[model samples]
Target: MGTIVVTGGTGTLGRHVTERLREAGREVRVVSRHSAPYAVDLRDGRGLDAALAGAGTVVHCATTPSGGDERAARRLIDAAGRAGVAHLVYISIVGVDRVPFGYYRTKLAVEGLVERSGLGWTILRTTQFHDLVLRVLQGAARLPLLLPVPAGVPDQPVEVREVAAHLAELALGEPAGRVPDMGGPEVRTLEDLAEAYLRASGRRRRVVRVPLVGASYRAFRAGGHLARDRAVGTGTFEDHLRRHFAPGARG
Candidate 1:
């Protein structure tokens, strides 16, 4: 294995991917706009060639959630192609093609770019993460009165560590275009996740189900973010809540 480059190496899942790659004794280089020594901005293409120069495989874990996911992906694809990287491994969300949500749409577009980029590539689609669900409810927990949540948006949240381990393995192997999707062991609604958070934290906030609006909600309701058949995760939502959020769990 040659030098392995990890984009967004400082971010949530990216951090785990980087750590796992390092743990596996791969020569790991992190690409990021700040902090990371390579300091490459995927959208801008600045420092990209230098960062990816000797990379045998480039693991793309970077995402611009506020927007620019497609653009950044395109930029990376172009740069990687130029750098002669052997394989491009991308971490994608499950149901990106089926979902009409903006982020998912962008992800689908990026997938197309990778397919046509004329480089060996592998895209690993995964379901939501446990931290994401907790973050949503944590934001709601700050509210004084009631905890507002989507009525029935179902989610299969997985552990970041598991997903990262999978990504690292993928990065080290031959490119397998659009690999099998991964998801959590348990499927739960947004409301259920929120209530669990509340209970774990010993908060008694009244639960309020608010009907979501727009095509995003429609896509969520269409089960666009689930991989029900592939429960690749070993941890449960309750296990995470109890370990990290439940009162005195650390003890």
Candidate 2:
């Protein structure tokens, strides 16, 4: 098989995806701003074509919350199209179309670009990752006493490794447009997740619910980001917490 280029290969999701592909004995070229030899910034086309040259599949995982995902996708698509890449697999959030958040909107727009890129493509929409939920709670726990979390919002946090394995499988196969959604084993309220986080970290902070205002918040509260029927992931958030806080885990 030809080389598979993975963007953002140094990042959390991309790292696992790259590892999975390599374990499968595939030729994997990791392209990122920090990845040497094949370093390329998705924000612009600089060095992107060189990284994508002779690649059979390109897994677009690089993303930012500070905006500009659309531009990045455009550059990547242009480069992939020119390089004669066969399949373009993209990772996206489950509620991109329903959520009004800027990042989600950008992701949805990127999905549209991938669909129209004139190359075979696959899109996998997944729920929030366990690491993200834990990170948010960790940040909130920085408060002296009470840990405030969004009221009425629930999250289904999937394991990143599981997602990476699936993405690798998709990359090794033919393009399948818009596959089924993937979700965590269980869906719990934000407050419940915060409390669980506190318990897992041995913190004594009281979990407080703060009602957020906005269409995006409303969509989240209404479970627009959840995939109750698609609870395909086997790992729970607690499982992630255990591994995260295990001995030598932080290192």
Candidate 3:
């Protein structure tokens, strides 16, 4: 098998992709600022070339936090094209085109870069992850009696593992352009999701749904961040919560 270079291989989803590729007995090269099994900084052209050398595929799971610049995506795309990488797989969020949020905008920009890079590429767009849901709820739970929910919105959150698996499959195959969008099986409100999380965690708390007044809220309320008709995840919020909150369970 040819070398598979996975950017951001240490991240939440990247780790799973790296493991899956490794389990398939493919030589894996990881790219990041920090040193690991392999290391390269996307911002540095020379480092990127060194990382892409002899690699047939590049799975890009790298992302900047909200409000950060998106130049990284352009840089990675340029490097992939210049290095003659055969396949470039990118992980993107669902509904990026409809959502006006800064992060989604950056994601859309990255998708465009990959599309026009001239390298064979695949884009896997997935919904919010189960861990993201928990993080939102848990952070809100820290505050007393106030759980801030996205007002009047529906979300179909999926498991990160499912997204990771789909991404790995794409990385191993020929580029299929934009693959099927993935999401959790059930549609849910943020309020209900938060309440479910609290109940699952054995917390007796009243949920106060706050009307988030902003572009973010408007986009979410319009379901601009969800996948329609392509929900393919096997785990539900309840299942995820049960596994997360189970006694002595380490996920």
Candidate 4:
């Protein structure tokens, strides 16, 4: 029932998490590069101590896909430890351990850091978010005549609001390390998702499947990133599309 700090509180998932926490009437501090009074960059530990001071829980949602997440997590752990924060909750991708992608590797490493940080910690791994899948499709749809997608790759895209609600629940409860993975209600192929996007956005493009070569691509094709058994999320990808393309839906 103390102040809770959310890193990257302005981001997609972080924003929802912050809203959920605030709805519960908990004191919430949003710490981010642009969050005034608590503008602390996670890349380094600068201004972190002040942000974490007297906070009971911290939801670590800040991550850099371009790299340097390990450094950021290390700095966060050290600061939380120094501030005597009770619980540290982290959001991670489901296949961090199975996928060989560089970003997944960094996420796995950050999970390890949280586990060994000697603090009350919890980690929730979920499948890809619907927004991320939409972004990929949108980028591919930008091509003149063809939308190229990874062949044989299936993604379970979960809703960010559901993940955020779960994270807020975890942040309020006692720390339970590495909880069960959360997945979307359905598993869909990239081609199918792309077609859906085209229909929703009213775009005309031929969807092409490209069998990309690489260990990471192979891992993705092999369903290493899926959580079929933990399909606890409620919203579907189509549901996301409707919301996304709705009139004045720009978030």
Candidate 5:
């Protein structure tokens, strides 16, 4: 097989993916807008012609949070075809099709594109990441005195490294095409997550659970982004908090 190319190599998940691939002694090529040997503007499709050349498998971890998930997927798909890349692996959130959000809609569109890209493709619909959860908690902590959390909004926040390892393993194998979703070991509510953050960090703030009402929150409350049966990740929210908030933890 040729080199394994990793898109979005600068992002949290992509970094771990590249690390795992290199540890396995695989010839890895990293494609990113910056901070990688193979710099490629995935949106404009620039540099991809050279970045994907001789690539056996291309892991699609790149994302445009603001918008343009579909544009990037189309660009990469065309590039992969021209480069003769074999497999295309994508990282997606669970329940993208079931959720009624713009981002989820865009992701579902990309999933469709990958399915019909005529290449061996695998899309792993994992739950939210611990990093994102932490960021939300941190933002909530900025409240004057109370951290407001949406009640009944549950999440299965898996660690990035776990997802990255899974992606690397999938990249080495034949395309499985919409394999089982990956999720954290346990399901938790947003309130529980906020409480954990406060407990771990010893923050002097109250966690207020507010009732959720919007469509997005309704989907989250209904477990739209959960894979209850496929809790493949071992790490838990408490475990992640310990790393940063344990006694003598990082300052």
Candidate 6:
């Protein structure tokens, strides 16, 4: 295997993917605009070719949450094509095809690009991360009195480490077009997750279910972003929370 380049190697998910690849004894190179093994922005064509030098596979993990994900993805694909890279692995979110959100729209567009790029590719669509749920809980803590959750919406948050490991395995093998969708072991509601977190931390808080009124809400309530049949994570929300509050445990 030639050098495998991981774009966005410095990000939350990217870091885990990078570490997994390194542990497998693969020659891994991180591509980023900042302090990576190779300094290359996906949007910068000039730097991309240099970074792709001798790289047999490219894991396109870099993303822009705003709206430029498709443009960046296109640039990366073109560069990879020019450099004759063998495989391109893309990380995307579940229900990106059904969601009307801008970020998901961009991801869908990039998936289209990969399908037509003629290079071996694999797209892994995963559910929201456990960290995202924790972030929501932490942000709602400021309200002082209520834990607001979208009514009737369910989430199955996966561990970032599991997603990273799956990606690494894909990078090491022949491209398997659109691998099975991955999610946490259990299905849960937003309010229940929030309550679990509060209880684990010993914080007394009232949980409230607020009706979401938009396309995003509709999709979420319909479980559009979750993988019900293909759930594949080892850690549960409670397990993750216990580890988080372990050192600070007082009993």
Tens digit of per-residue lDDT, candidate 2, span 1-251: 68999998999999999999999999999999989998887887799988998999999999999988899999999999999999999999999999898889989999999999999999999999999999999999999999999998989999999999999999999999999999999999999899888888899998899998999999999999999999999999889999998888972
lDDT: the better of candidates 4 and 6: 4
Residue 174 of model 5 has an lDDT of 94
* lDDT of each candidate versus the true structure: 0.88, 0.93, 0.84, 0.95, 0.89, 0.87
Give the Å error, residue 3, model 3. Answer: 0.7
Query: How many pairs collide in each candidate, listed in order?
Result: 0, 0, 0, 0, 0, 0
lDDT of 6 by residue, 1-251 (tens): 79999999988789899999999999888988895457876665558888888899999889878666777888888888888899999999999988787788888889999989989999999998887888888888768887777799899999888899999999999989988899889899888898899998787779888886889789888888989998879899998788778986542
TM-score of 2: 0.98
TM-score of decoy 6: 0.93
If scored against the real structure, what TM-score would every candidate get? Answer: 0.94, 0.98, 0.93, 0.99, 0.95, 0.93
Worst 10 residues of 6 by lDDT: 35-44
Model 5 Cα lDDT, one tens digit per residue, 76-171 = 999999989999999998999888978998999999999999998999999889889998899989988999988878888898889999999999
- Kindly list the per-residue Cα lDDT of model 3 for residues 5-42, writing each as its tens digit: 98889888998999998888888888877855456656
Worst 10 residues of 2 by lDDT: 242-251
Which residue pairs collide, candidate 2? none
Q: Report the C-alpha lDDT of model 4 over 1-251, residue by residue, as the tens digit.
A: 67999999999999999999999999999999889999998997789999999999999999889888899999999999999999999999999999999999999999999999999999999999999999988988889999999999999999999999999999999999999999999998999999999999999999999988999999999999999999999999999999999999985
Instruction: Give all candidate RMSDs, comma-separated.
Output: 2.1, 0.8, 1.8, 0.7, 1.6, 2.5
Which 10-residue window of candidate 3 scores lowest in summed lDDT?
A: 37-46
Give candidate 2 regions above 4 Å deviation: none
User: Lowest lDDT 10-mer window, candidate 5?
Assistant: 242-251
User: Regarding lDDT, does 1 or 6 come out ahead?
Assistant: 1
